[model samples]
Target: MNQDLIQTFIEETEENLQVVEESLLDLEQAPADQELIDLVFRAMHSIKGGAGLVGFEEIGELAHYLENILEEIRQAANPKLPDDIFNLLFAGIDLIRQMIEDNDLTAKSVGRELTELKKAIKHYQLVTQEGSSDEQTIQQQTGQKYYKINLKFRETIFETGTDPLMLVLELEEVGTILASYLNREQVDDLFHLNPHLLLMNWTIFLESEQSLDKIEDIFIFVKEDNQIVIEEISEELEQWFSGGEETEKLLRKEEFISNVDLDQVLAKQEQIGESLFLQSKTTKEETGQADKQVRNLHKQKRTETIRVATDKLEGILNDIAELLIAQSRVKELATGIVGLDRSLQSEIVNSFQEVDKLIRRVQEEVMSASMIPIGDTFTRLKRMVRDIAAEKEKDVKLVISGEDTELDRKIIEQLADPLKHLVRNAVDHGVERPEQREKLGKPPTGTIELDAYHQEGSIIIEIVDDGRGIDKEAVLAKAKEKGMIEQESQLDDSEIYNLLFKPGFSTAQEVTDISGRGVGLDVVMSNIKDIRGNVEVFSEKNQGTKIKIKLPLTLAIIDGMIVRVGGERVVIPLNSIVEFIDASKQQIKQVEGKGLIVSIREQYIPCMALNELLQLEGSFNNLKEEPTGVLIILKDDQKQIAVQIDEVIGQEQVVIKNVKENMGQAEGIAGATILGDGNVALILDVPTLFKLAKRLKVG
Candidate 1:
């Protein structure tokens, strides 16, 4: 199998598995929800499709069998679904995943079990077809290949002046219309309904002399922007499609008692001749009314969501990073050579410029591939809260909105565990019990809401719970007991609340498996900070608690203020620099033997000189008469820090590369990136370094 195709299959399968997990959770609530069933079914469908494409036949066959059972349930009304069915289904999903993973089939083979599963589902369906049946066993062979396409696009696709309808209609011109089903269900009451969004699927049984290339060309323009799948189903699709005919025919007469094909099902529903009890208003008007009623039945058809794998995209990003590095190397080599080749340098520079533009374009697309809706993390919390609320015997409703808001995939993944722990804590520690809430004149049911929205180049995720708010006095007492605070420490409300994230500190009177470990918030804070994010807590005496986390949209390229320390170039994140100043030695004043504060332009600003803290070799800090190095004033809420440097090297948008693990976290270096001269500039971890310096001076 081709590596690229296999990689794509892996990426898509993982996404499908994520959706399957989510749908499985939902299935516990509404097993008959066709959309949920379809979601699980299509996940298998995709696994089967992709596996076959990548020559993983045994895995494809397993997934195909699993999909058959779900398809049976999905197509039925009030499906006789048991949890055992999905248990088996989940097992099937797991097995197929295992098979794909074990591509080499090193251990025990699942080929025999897969064969047994297919026969079992068929035999059961055949055995149970007498009274009630979900499907007639879709006889899809794993060997066949066919394209199954779905296209329900965002409105922007139409603004491109492309008619998706016309495109589909043109597709009809190229192939035999096979399994065409129009979801005209959404066409509703004309007076108040929307007609612009076309809802239909016309599966063409394409048998063209022209190659699949021609069939694919019809969709080339909008394919990338729309939900379009060009794939190969099975070789024996006719057999598969017709396998349900026996089931369909059986249901046509005998099994028509309670479903879509019931005898006089329309007559039983239709009221004729003035209802024979109301009035004689049954006429063309009645026919129109019946049509109107059926129109709005068009439910939203879902497409299998996909994303390129992060490691795959990361591979590409690494390549681009390498490309930029190589480009820098090229420019480095072209610099003023002894051969005196001005024309050659000029051409090389031009080539480097062109390559840079192409590299940036590819890098941007790869970054976009890494973006995902923040809602995925938000959805997982609903179940957690529900279960927690139930355990405590309290009513807590989780209201999640803004789920469609997107964030960098890395941030979203990193956020899940933290958010889960937070929500769990909110319910366990924050929400009041039912009796306590009733006494306080509060509603018995507390509401925990997870909201996300994009603002000004960052994604803001907020977890707000309406519960008995954090008591500042209580927190302060706890802080005092732990010796985390002074006897007369005067702190503002924000500072008091921020103390909850202190290591090994919690207000919970008793420890449970949930919130009492005291490691949750500290971990959350550290993780968020690591991603260049800020986390803040908000609470009142009785209203609620809300934790807001703001994270930047991307981690690739960032603007950094450059400075030279130890004659070695270092870059500081531009966001952290409060101000810069040139000061005299008499202007610098030491405080508590910790950091020096200088009154520049009236107010005293504390500073930690980089040379002193970094202890870089060379002597720039021992200034006797005047301030020798430049002061780049860095400040956070904790204290102010000025990294005195050899020179102010200005700023640039530097692409960051992570510090190697073996060398450990660099003392001041956040990451390393290539400068225009091809030299690697270390980016300073100003926040951590500043805090570390504060602790050192205090110690």
Candidate 2:
């Protein structure tokens, strides 16, 4: 097999598996839905056929059994499915996924699990068939019909190890082969022939009571490489064959066709093949070449786009970044030149401006291409919640919103594990059982909502549940018991709730598969923070718990407001800055020895000197020393704080380079960027700065 063909098969199989997983989740909710059943059956059936073509026998077998169960259900023989059936099917899905990932088909690897699933399926099918005798009887009343199948194998079919004889054998299992015509005129003489090449076509007249879907399934393994045309010809085909002399039916002794008629049809097919072959052989070589060129041009016109590897796109971005840095340096040099011609300087500025615009446009296009919807991650979470709920014997419904919202590919890739942990936590610890919920006058089915939306150039994801909220008392007791917090520590409700994220701080009575090793939420927080994001929890006694995470739009670049903190430069994200103000002495008042509070728009906001917060040398320690210090009013969602600075420089779009990799996460700093003058300025994390200011005020 070609490497490209293998990669394409892997990508397509994974996509179809996603559909299968989603449809199974939907079927768990609406067991009687025919469309959902069909969707799942089709997805699994496709995977089975495709995997067989690629020689992944384990995946093909798993999908085949799973598809069989779904087919029985669709036929109304298994109306009241047992809950265990879903488990078996889910196990089949996992088994197939693992096989695809490892590319293994050894019997020792998946034989036990495969046997268990098949056993359960066979048992259920037997029981269901016993009760569905009447349905089977009605199905048999639909008499057998004849189908004419024309199969022309692609020239390269032998390369894929596809034996046309196997397909014919499969057809024989379904019905009687009345007559057949084999076209082998394309076969060359033994001296010139390619032994591994396929040069034959087959036309078969088959009589079976099976539906067209079943007939199509016979050739599903080779249908893509072989042209298969199946049509119902029970009525019209008889008249055409009745006029010709037939011959002996070597394969079947059925009365459908006599020997004389079969011989006559074979003779006619040979004459037709010879005439077409001779006509093609006599065509001028130039004319044939011209026709081939026209076909190639037509194919090129049809395919307008092609897939490019991610690394190639990353290379383009790296070149663009370098170009941007050089552009900045040229602009800075242009500004510093003295005694230059005014017109030439002006043209240089204009040209730089135009280049800047073009660079931005290119950056946007590349970023847009790199973005994909968060829906795939959301779907995976839904399946996780469903499986966990089933295991825990809970009735839960997951509602998702803003699934079409797109995010940077890098951000989305790291998002899956964190999101999975959060959802599993919700299912295991937050949601109450049906019995408990009914006693509390709530709906028997609990609801968990997964939502995502864009806010101020960031993506906010919230997981909200309608189960019994976090037990603050239990959390506090656990913290005290684990020596995580002092017994006399003064903690508010938010602080108490936040203790859930402390390492090894779980309150569950015992460890289970879902959660309770006390490692999930802390990992969630750490993962979110690695992307320069934050997660907060809110809960009430009986209402529920909500975990909201805020992440940046992208990892590489952002628009920032550059400012001076007593001669040192720093960058604050533009999205977080509300406005700048020149605060006078009287407006800044100290509360005891704590930080200053600046009055803005009739509201008092905590004010801290940026120099003091960052603790830098050669910085103003006192806010009142300056006649009128600049105050940057920053907001993070609903919280606001003021950072007093010496000067407010202009804003610019800066490329963010990670500082944590070298500096290891500085306080009040998210990352660093280069100024136009080639100076490195630290990017301030507004949320962290707000928290620092609050601690300063409370001290």
- The best candidate by TM-score is 2
Estimated TM-score for each candidate? 0.57, 0.82
Instruction: Tell me how many clashing residue pairs each candidate has.
Output: 10, 11
Candidate 2 lowest-lDDT run of ten: 279-288
lDDT of 1 at 563: 85
Off by over 4 Å in 1: 1-309, 336-351, 453-458, 472-503, 529-534, 550-557, 575-608, 613-644, 650-655, 660-669, 674-680, 686-699
lDDT of each: 0.65, 0.75
Model 2, 438-507: lDDT tens digits are 9989999999999999998889999999889989988998899899989987777877887887888888
lDDT of 1 by residue, 1-699 (tens): 557666767767767876886787678768656556655765666666556556666766666677667756643545666555766676666666676577643225776666666676676666556545434332222221234444555545544434566666556655644433333334457786655654433333333332343356556446556666554333433322342454235324421123432333333223221132222112111111332222125334657765445798777777777776676666556675624866676677677678767777887887887777887777767657766777888888788899998777777777787888888988998899989988888998898988998764567889899898889998898899899989888766867887988888887777787778667888877677667667778898778999988776776776678788777877887877877766554377667765566666777766655766776666666533456677787755445666677787776556777664544645555678888786777777665675467556622
